[model samples]
Target: MENKTKKNAVVLLSGGLDSATCLAIAKSQGFDCYCLSLDYHQRHIAELHAAKNVANVMGAAAHKTANLDLSLFGGSALTDDAIAVPESETAGIPITYVPARNTIMLSLALAWAEVLKSQDIFIGVNALDYSGYPDCRGEYVKAFQAMANLATKSAVEGHAITIHAPLIDMTKAQIVTLGTELGVDYAMTVSCYQADSHGEACGLCDSCRLRREGFAAAGLADPTRYKKHV
Candidate 1:
């Protein structure tokens, strides 16, 4: 950590509850947060809008959105128009899992952290209640951190970049509770895999279901706007 009065960190803000909550946690820890969101051409741009709102409301020092075309590969429901966003949760890894999404996002974050000469990156990846995404696991985050340490000039110079996954072990309910305590506005986040242009959630997507359930478990009123979902 630098001897500056406040440490600087790059927070990956997805405009979802977890990421927003993660940003709040980082802020609470006294870090000057630089928020990053990715526009990988997902099914809707609503989440990007939510990310922007969260970053602004949280009073981030800066926010940057990087544009990428993950749909060029198009295997996942999010990136491919042909693949429908699954309304029901299926077993195993779901169709919504965009291949190498976190990997690419972290790589980009790592690049920016190096440019900023910061040694901290915060992501909101969780293993429990994570809707079967393999990359959200604890081991995956550790592996990425190890790779980042070996791959960056900062590491060689002894300023090791710490990839922080603050919500990795928390369940959705716990996440919601923590975020609420940190003053994260749930209504501003769009966690739905298929949110409408206005940022209204589909309610039936795995992400939405989990988010809804989280609020329920936390005994909080869900402020998410939803379309007429079956």
Candidate 2:
């Protein structure tokens, strides 16, 4: 751990519940957090706004946003405007999966972490109760960490950085519970792919369903605005 008396980390804050919760977790760990959000041409800019709010509320040491046009390589619903965000059964890997999103985001965060001389980067990726995004898995994150260490000067100099996924194994309900204990305001975060103009969550989408069910399982009140109570 290299005697981290000045422990600092870069957090990938998507302004969603998980990411926001991750930010809180990082803070709780006594890390001076630097939050990074991306504008990857997703359907909703609302999430970006929520990210900003979360960063400010959580008291990030620094908050930065990057504008990357993933739509330029459009294939997923998040980038391709032609495809609608699905609300059906997620049989396999959903179409909404943006190719290499976590990879790209982590790459950028790695660069920032090196520049900041931070020892860790926190991401909100989860494997349980999540759409089948491969990058969210523990193996993928581990591989990325190794790659990051090998690819950067910091790692080459024996400053082995870590990619922290505090929510990797947690279900959404457990996540919600942790966030609630951390005094996180779920209403301030947006998790819906199809959020309305007013920032209300579309209760029919996979994300919405998972979020609602998680809250139900945790016996917590979801403060998010839903299009309908399913």
Candidate 3:
């Protein structure tokens, strides 16, 4: 079978485990990756640094950071200092949901894909592990793909864009397993909403809870520095 997917792909990397895994997956699938990270003025800057390192280690074609001040529109915990990031996973949507974040990021990624004429864009969003973010849902991604195709001139002309979310259905443990198989060093990835200046993972945030649980469930030691894991 002639491979329809080109060697080039744009990956949305957040310097987190899921995104790093996505990058590894894309590369393993024979796609030369162009990693895109965003500096949207989130509380944690460590993930951005981690993204760069992961991209380098994973051998992405290029890793670029886009500066968009989502902090200017601060309402969510990630962007606002006044809002405390929840440490536990409560029922329903959490307060950490950044409004339209994936939407904005994916739109930018679509533009890049259209310019490069790339058929695939990989994101690491997962519904199971996700924290009640409306945009992270599988259905939303599909809708976004359809909308993107119709909105873009390239898709209108004939070349359709595919938004690929391989980690959408997988649990965190499964993701950890896949990343381990792919030779991804989990130590290189950071998943803390609030980290110290040196990027030490905060052991109390919801993100930390998820990461710790994933490692525990996978029966693997988390390489990240943490206070505790359960």
Among these predictions, the greatest TM-score belongs to 1
lDDT tens digits by residue: candidate 3, 1-230? 22465467999999999999999888888887999999999997888999999999889899899999998999899999999988777788787888889998898888888877887899999999767788888999999999998899888899889999999999999999999998999998888989776678879888888888898999998898864553
What's model 1's TM-score? 0.97
The C-alpha RMSD in Å for every predicted model, in order, reads 1.9, 1.9, 1.9
Q: Rank the candidates by lDDT, best first.
A: 1, 2, 3
Q: Give the higher-lDDT candidate: 1 or 2.
A: 1
TM-scores for all predictions: 0.97, 0.96, 0.95
Q: Model 3 off-target regions past 4 Å? A: 1-6, 227-230
Which 10 residues in a row give candidate 3 its minimum summed lDDT?
Answer: 1-10
Q: Candidate 2 at 181: error in angstroms?
A: 0.6
lDDT of 2 by residue, 125-211 (tens): 999989998989999999999888889999899899999999999999999999999989999999999897778888988888899
The segments of candidate 2 whose C-alpha lies over 4 angstroms from its true place after superposition are 1-4
Best by lDDT: 1
lDDT of each: 0.93, 0.91, 0.89
Error of 1 at 22 (Å): 0.4
Error of 3 at 73 (Å): 1.2
Q: Which lDDT tens digits does candidate 1 get at residues 1-230?
A: 23347888999999999999999899888899999999999999999999988899889999999999999999999999999988987999999999999999999999999999999999999999788898999999999999999999999999998999999999899999998888888889999999899999889999989999999998999999999644
Q: Least accurate stretch of 10 residues (summed lDDT) in model 2?
A: 1-10
How many residue pairs clash per model? Answer: 0, 0, 0
